[model samples]
Target: MKQYLQSGIVGFSLTVVALLMPVNGIAQSIGSDKNTLPDIGVVASEALTVDKEMLIGDAIMRQMRGQAPIIDDPILSEYIQDLGNRLVLQAENTKFPFEFFVINNSAMNAFAFYGGHVGVHSGIITSADSESELASVLAHEVTHVTQRHLARRALSQQRSSPLQIASMLGSILLAAANPEAGMAALQTSSAISQQMTIDYTRSNEQEADRIGIDILYNAGFDPRAAATFFGKMAEEYRLRSRPPERLLTHPLTEKRIADARSRMARYPEVRLPPSLTFHLAKARLLARYQFDPDYALEHYMAVNEQGNYLVKEAARYGLAIALLANDKAAQAQEINNELLKRDPNNLFYIDLATDILIALNQPQTAVEMLEKEIFNKPRNSVVVLNLANTYLTMKQYSKTIELLRDYLLVKPHDQLAYSLLSEAYKSEKSYKGMHQSKAELLALYGAYPNAIDELQHAYNYTGDDHLEKQRIRARIQQLRDAEEKLRNF
Candidate 1:
């Protein structure tokens, strides 16, 4: 089977890969005027249509699922998606739906792929001092997609072989995943190729920054955050021999920092209040994703005792999560209860409370609370997944299956749902359903052969049901065709 690169590499890095050929478009004057932003809209679709871009993006995303250390936390995933959508709403020429996710890496990097997929490292969230700083990075990535920079770069490389294009993109992704191996693979390419890629990316970088700042401002974030974030990254890594992956993909020049500050000056200064959700999300990362549970607990406890955090509630929230991680379930429940009492409707608190409740062996209480959330926010991934998990704990296999089947209809790409559904099916002794669900889970990871084998297993359990067998056969063929198409692409 042919494997593509991990998806969600930096927007500029992907565009840089496309720099395998010549870049089009005249370099617009960056300082043309403070009032009017340049219109770098979508280029010609004849070279690479939206459909093709989506297909390529999906292929890369599948490969990424197989290879990348994707964070599977629904709460964090939901938070990032909501944040990205806020910017997407203000963005122009948005031709596709947007999906945002987080990677479980400590290195500071963020990336966007052909489809509306954007991913940020957990490190970025932990490092960001404010939500706007995080939003600023996201806004830039969103602009890359809205402006169709990747498609434009591909358009310029229309004469190149598809495999060559894929290889370039894959090498960058490999570098992101394994720097030494990836750098070796990249060095095999010509030095001239690397130079051209950098030279062209500079212009696109300018455009993305200019447009992204506007998106950030329009979305009601601090526009100066763009400048502040850029300056911060540059200064932090200034004396280092090796910069962060973000600085590598998005080369931070002194001029870029100055330009961001100059452009941000055009917007009116507004002081926004502290975002509790952002802090909570960051705390979640620190407590659970970043450090050892014991260390995280001590860190949060110190923050709480010292009272030296951006948000006091967020500090306590972090402590609660750490307590849970350390298996102090009773203490965690007490903390969560207090937090919930204050913010009765906050999903972050509620999600954690649900976990705490479940851990306390109060499945019925957890079910009741989550059921209410489901009623209020039907089809909400966070609530639904939590509820499904609660059902599994309660050994309500049939209910778990029913709930997940409905949930999957809405979120078909959710690997977590498929995994849960597969377990529920197995627990309920529905062998065919178990195999079928497992097949989809494998497919998401781009394991086409294994997924096909799973379907065949499911087919064997069909017990001569002609219609079911026919459907299985058709599904198997579809997987085969999809795999074949990906090989060529």
Candidate 2:
């Protein structure tokens, strides 16, 4: 339970879902500036419930990652999914599925996207001094999600927008396209709805702290870990001879950590589960996929001094990932085998084994492994995408279309997913599929830069529009012209 945090709220995408308060005096907080449910209230909280929160969160996730997440690596994806699901089940509302992840960034922070999307910086994994310490962070974010703090914050601010959810969904992509611009926009938009950003009162902080401990204890995890992580951050502050700036949001200090310890003093420590080992194992893997392996190797060994099997697995995965990235396939393969021996049923190991086979010029074997992965992860878009890529490699265009079409059913709004689906359709002479897919693409991404370009693309490929298309097209040209004039000035 040791840690360090940066001044800025580490964001996964430019748009972070946050809850703001109507208090101008507290327009900002540490590790908070993201658009959270707390920042954007449910507008209709009289009937708000956990199920509804999950639905909204899922919708936000779909908008942020699209239906089929772009997971180039299956081993890494499945592992993180499993790890996230484990903690999600332990939170207050098990009905709400929480998806945890290591975003591909080097920022030293972690944050939760409203809905079940909890993200940690690739750097956080490498920085964790102990595996349980990481669990403490996940528990804190889970508290945010299960508590519906985002919606609460929104209601408090009295923020209202006609577009509501659509604007919220668009916020993520805005972050993706330009994080700074999106963050600025978020700040401005929030100010209109609330005061700006509300630094939670000490009472609010204490409540989150209490609930966070309850979550940790109930999840069968050590409550003390929460205190330890904060303690570590406090220590970091002393090391620098200055209080960590993130303290503005998190309010960290030995006093806060001691306070947290007192809150959990009555609770007995629970052994973290076997699943957490898998979580740390995968966190280590994903961190490598997201960061520099050399740095990862040094970090892994340091964090896993406990030599717990799972933490060691994390280091091993980190080491293999580095070797593979450096073109040392032979060495990577050896590590894969070692991992397989430890966890033969592990989805990640199975997938990694296949990746190694594919890299070693064993196409036929790779196909078999990928086909199995697809069958196992039937609902996962990235799994299907990988299988589709494998088909493309084998020159099976029809098979590619079949796989991509299935993927589009789950994630039609993703530009890359749609583009690939369009290519597959075009290759198979499925003109109807190709035309419909293109129009869908234009509608989503067309709203960016200039709407006219997207409208024109839709008009050319938008086969049959019965309503809304022409009206939308007209509005697009007008907006495009307006945008151009604004740019000229």
Candidate 3:
């Protein structure tokens, strides 16, 4: 079973990398101008258009969802997306929309695919000592997208057979996730020379590092964090017989570390304080993804025992989450209440507190609290989703549907909202409504064929409701159009 799962993951990862490859003629001009940094925007401007990249990215993302264990936590997704966008606003030549996701893997690595999709492993978040360190890695990945390194590589090596290029790209991605598997893939493929691939990858890494520091500095993060993180990774690489997956692709050498430090020296030293959200995000990964509630509780208790007040508070917040996960609802509630006393307006504390209340079988209390929060922060998706969940728990199917439907109107791409709406429809015994909600959810992941079939089922269930049937047919046509557009790439 383990081998089967591993094979499935590798195959899926390859499909993702394969779909992002540049078309035949798009990359021919990539290396024509030696003076230019393979500026993908200039070279493939006509061939590898932004719209095509989006189509490719969206298609691969759907395949990934179907195969990988991508975390579906809305809060974590929102936090990472916000962080990526913050950096994007400061980045140069960003022509595509940036999307961030967390892979439920423990490998200390991150990667950027076509378009602006960046995937960070949960382990990296837990590994960082401060928010800036995490931001530094994200900045580096963002640079890859902004500079168009992947697209350039696709264009530069367009001479290689498609299968060969796919194999190389797949190996790089596998290496980012697991070094052993990646190395094995490389050994099996004779399509590309190891040394050549290494040299090109090194150049891309250097360029991304040089540009990433500037983006990090401009975005108000301490640039030194990049050097610091790289230095740490270098040491880890030295200690291990086989380096981590990140080292295989990034190749953090002594010179790279020194260069990052030199770049940091150019900027004024800034001791940016750690962000609370960063701590909460790390805590969420520990309590949820790691599935080690006891370990989280113990680790946080130790940190609280010796750390400063700010650190202590962060640790306490983590402990509360751990407590909740361990089914100690009352204890978690007590900790949340105390935290709320210190900062009553903290959404994180309030949301967790509301969750504790619901776990304690106090659904009405959860509803009252979340409703007030929603009124205060009307556009807050997290609070609104929480309220919708509370309504679902109370078996108020109509209220749940109404809230989710209204929210979905504004943010139709929200996966969690669609999922909740589907559940509400199921509870209400509305087969047509249930399938329709599911269709929207599937469509978000680029599962157009499945989505179309779902709408067809809904149309069938509509029977005599001509109006509803017409609406379903219209949505099916839209899905077909999207599928056709994807195929054009």
Candidate 4:
């Protein structure tokens, strides 16, 4: 989150080629005597089993890691995941592990794919006027995953090969991030007519909206949020020459918005207080992700002075972030100190304070604060990652390595952890460890060959450690097998 990001090209180009592979019968409908769509539960599994869906999902997710501008902030991730899981708890037909992540894009879009992964763009958070609006969007995406809409789409083309199915699925996923490119891929990848895909996708949206509202209400969000958010979207984009990515993918019609209103009307009206964390999250994005430091500082200062924000503390939090970014670490620390005094256990304040302390050259103080927080919430990602970062700043390489190694047990796919571990290994002159960590980082981006090369370097750097050499060789082989698997798919 602190660092700017770059999407890789190598794996992305490979996946784009895969998206161009031809599918012969993707447009064909199921042979039904009644000319009716079959029940998804009965046939979706037959076409694309859960295991195959997950495999394709993993491959695409790895590519996205390499190609998409994904945010690696632990605090933001924790907040979004917590919010997503609350709605997931009320969802039905959830068959796989759900992962929530944010992409560092200024587009109003959210997408869900196979393997229960949902991605939100930063613009969606900034655009949302309330937590319930954000939650409504998440609930819709969750429904898409749980209902297995993508797999059901595959079920229509039962005569197609697995490779064709994988290509088609990949096209839909690609469209979520890059609409024009994905549309081209979809056209070449499938024989399915554009209208047909749109029709099916529209149907899926209707179903998702119906179920998402229930999930949102059951999760304690106002049901009317669904309709209100839809109205906001329609109004905002009504006369725009180019609508956002979400509108492109979702295709919001007047009927859709009206349907949302009618459906939400069934539930009794409810009024809820503002969400502090949601505003804080939005402010964090504004202060750190979107604007320059100086502009952010001025914006937050105005918000704080005028008290125009939904939450006062969130405005102050933004001010602190802007202060930190502007190199006013002492002022940032003072604001953070006040915030922490008010809510000593808030992870948001703790993480910001950690950054401020490190900036002030007080690594020991940051370490002491983070360590205490970690002791109380042993698995809290915010505290753990902050502590690991503090250790790296303190040049406690061994401690950094140890903490990240354990943290990876829970978040093996965390690219930031791998990067930090690699830095620590390099600083400690552990060439083998450094190469091994770098290998994992590359592998996460689907650069299997590069990963294998790094493992070989690790093996060469290995001393007389027979077990370590063997492990490196095994890892190299695993990457080779994975590369082969992806190639075939």
TM-score of 1: 0.89
| Model 2 Cα lDDT, one tens digit per residue, 1-489 | 001111232334332332211111101221222233232223424334444455555445444443212332434445556655655655432444566655555434555645567766555555555555666677666655555555565554454432353344445334443467655655644432432243344545554566556655555567777777787677677788655433544566566677888766566556654454445445544544455766655554455555654556756766666666667778888987898897765655655565576678775776786677666678664456556655665667788777777777876644555666667677777665565556555444333343355455545544576454675576566656644532342
Better lDDT candidate (2, 4): 4
Worst 10 residues of 3 by lDDT: 18-27
Higher-lDDT candidate of 2 and 3: 3
Please give each candidate's TM-score: 0.89, 0.68, 0.85, 0.89
In model 1, how large is the Cα lDDT of residue 246?
84
- lDDT value, residue 455 of candidate 3: 91
RMSD of each: 5.1, 9.1, 6.5, 6.5
- Once fitted onto the true fold, the runs of candidate 1 whose alpha carbons sit more than 4 angstroms away are 1-44, 179-200
Expressed as tens digits, the lDDT of each residue in 136-200 for candidate 3 is 99988887777666556656666653334434554555543445666676677653364244332
- Best-to-worst TM-score order: 1, 4, 3, 2
Q: Which stretches of candidate 3 lie over 4 Å from their true place?
A: 1-40, 159-200, 306-310
Q: What Cα-based lDDT does every candidate model obtain?
A: 0.77, 0.54, 0.71, 0.77
Listed per model in order, the count of residue pairs whose N, CA or C atoms clash below 3 Å is 0, 25, 1, 0
Error of 2 at 184 (Å): 5.5
Q: RMSD of candidate 4 to the true fold?
A: 6.5
Predicted candidate 1 versus true structure: per-residue lDDT over 109-134, tens digit per residue:
78786667787888888989999999
Candidate 4 vs. true structure, TM-score: 0.89
Candidate 2 has an lDDT of 0.54
